[model samples]
Target: MTLLIETRELAVAAADSIVQPTSIRVRAGVPFTILGETGSGKTLLAQAIAGTLPDGLVARGEILIAGRPVQDLAVHERRALWGREIAILPQEPWLALDPTARSIDQVAEVYEVVRRRPADGARDDAVEAMRSLRLEGAGRKLPSELSGGMAQRVALAASRAGGARIMLADEPTKGLDAALRDGAIDLLREAMGSEGGLLTITHDISVPRRLGGEVAIMLAGRIIEQGPVEDVLQRPRHDYTRRLVAADPANWIRRIVPERFGDPVIEARGLAKFRGGRLLFSGLSLTIARGEIVGVVGPSGSGKSSLGDLVLGLIRPDAGSVRRDPRIAPLRFQKLYQDPPAAFAPQLTIRRALADLVARHRLDATRISDLMRRLRLSDGLLDRPPGAISGGELQRFALLRVLLLKPAFLFADEPTSRLDLITQQEMIELIVESAREEGCAVLLVSHDRDLIDKTADRVLALEGSWMDRDAVA
Candidate 1:
């Protein structure tokens, strides 16, 4: 086997504080995978290799691409290696996409500009890629118009557009359905092709299990366990690795559903909405009672978010109406966004942002400390900007702020899609517990049916023209 990318004693740090020293090597055809919880430095490792680390972070040690030493390379030299030698699929890739650019155009631009393909040929290749990913219908839609899953596919197309030999993929299945996830994985495997290499960082255990080659478990910015996938995952050695594997939701049998109920918090009747040039839903009626956990499960772009927005009155229904409790204020209704970074101010630290919210709402400042302790967040994280923390960490902060408002209803849209299995379980547990205590009506949307199965009291399934409701006992 030939080596494509190698890092020796590679370490990342902020100012003088170093996280951990890591070394990884990718062979010509085998995929190297890293599995870790959020904020465990998995993404930082990939970003270090790609030379795309966030602001205030620095990398040290040796980096080699295609047997060429590049750690000390100039900015332009390192940048020049992109597209031709190395390509990266960023976490939350949708955020990297141009909001105004059409999906196809974004992918095609990589071919035309980076690969130097002709305009006609670039577009044709992009079209083929999109078609293969089942995104043929989203070519003309803007990134904003596309669902998170569609945006993810589009990003994959763009990354592969340049035909890079060594690819670094971060959370490639962040927001994808199982079918789409398989397709994306297949594409990644194809990209490795005998002569190419792949380095993947993901929280999804199944990704490494299926890809199969080598796996490393990262914890607190260090690789605690590294070996063959089966050996590391099935017969784990480290205690943390053992807990991580055992924490998977797949192992859960069933969740306890409470019998206590409250008055209706909101009601929707004959609701209809047209989106993405199609009828999302028609004559849809549902009511959520206070203290109820309503789970919404659907494929991407199947109108899960749209339905939440409609019920929240963020958007007017085409043919029906949503009615809320006459005594409750509109501010009592909150939403936990799928993309955490987009929810906060880039210029402010977490502490400042939370304080501002408290002042604006006249909320008790003590609530922040109480909630932070419950969420297992450190006071140190509050001093950092939103972009400085991990997505999962930021999401917990989002939930903390929303809870401070004492919301009557919360629409959590794929709140755990980007989180590790442990974090996902913890957040859902907090949400359910809070609903019980606060009498908050929760309309939770997720691509993971298992999560919906465990956390939701009543499950609402939506995919295309299909709609079904079932009570979990």
Candidate 2:
């Protein structure tokens, strides 16, 4: 089989080297994955291949597509080639999508640009592609109206519609639930069969295993090991790969000692929520006693986030009521939103944002510094705006902001979904420990069953306004 894409000692650098000299190949009709932890330069390599590296980043070595040297091509030539032969599924779909345009139109535009098809024909193809990824009727909706998972599918639909020969997907399933993730994997597999080759970069180890591809383990910008998926992941040769495999959530043991709970700090009774004239949920009831950690688990778009908003009084319930202890002040209730970047002002520096929160809460500088240290954040990070930092860093900062308030009740909604396994474990441990120390009742809304099992004292299975007790740990 002919090689679809090949990198020969390809290196990328910005001020300092980001990706070390690396060589890799993707054959036609095959899938390959690059696995690495956060800030390990996997994304840089992907960007280098796509010729989309940000300004100030320099590329060295050679990148070939269908036996053509991309480096030798003019800017316009490279752009034309990219439109026809390559498509990128970005790490953050929302960033890639235009908020003003309808999703379907955005996807159809790709087909029109790359395939030069008629508008009507491109529209039909775009809709068909969306349907293949289970995104029916999502075409008319603007990106702002779609959920994180829905937006991801839209991005995938656009990539598929582009009819590119090689696909580069970066953290394709970062925010999706298990079912959606599986659907995405299937779509990518289908694309591989049609598109000739697929290269995926992700921190999620399960992705490579599920895609059944060649795996390349990246550490500190270097590809330290490469082989079949099972051999590389299961029987890794490098210490870094072995550590990553071991750091899988499945290997982590829960050591949370059960503590007795007091009276309810926050309670929701027969709660109901509606969106877009559809009932998201109704007749849901739950309680978070003081010092208790209650885990809420459900499928995507099943109102887990809605329930969190209801508890936090961010959204009014259509029915029933949410009550918090009268003694607990309103400021004592904090929410850690799922999209950390959206929670802050984009133009404001992290230091300015944290300072405002600190001043509002009358918190001391010492306490803020201590919290930053605990979260493994550096002092320099405070100088950058929210958009300038990584998702994981932004998430940690968001958590730090909420924790500074020393809330009596904390609502954490998929707080660590963007973090790597090791960081996820660390954040979970810190949340549990801090919440316990402060006697703060927590409502942890997540789709990760292992995470819930490890952190929650009790679990509630949510199914469209109904809550069933899954277990009491």
Residue-level lDDT tens digits of model 1 in 430-473: 89887998899999998887778877889987765521121100
Quote the positional error of residue 68 for candidate 1 in Å.
1.2
Among these predicted structures, which one has the highest lDDT?
1
- The per-residue C-alpha lDDT of model 2 at residue 164 equals 79
| lDDT comparing candidate 1 with the true structure | 0.86
Q: When superposed on Cα atoms, how far off is each prediction in RMSD?
A: 4.1, 4.5
Query: Which tens-of-lDDT digit does each residue in 89-191 have in candidate 2?
Result: 9887878899899988899998887889999898888877877766654677888777677788888888777777788999998877777788898788887
Which candidate number would show the highest TM-score if scored against the true structure?
A: 1
Off by over 4 Å in 2: 72-74, 255-259, 464-473
C-alpha positional error of residue 318 in candidate 2 after TM-score superposition, expressed in Å: 1.2
C-alpha TM-scores of all predictions? 0.96, 0.92
Q: List the residue pairs that clash in candidate 2.
A: 29-196
The regions of model 1 sitting more than 4 angstroms off are 465-473
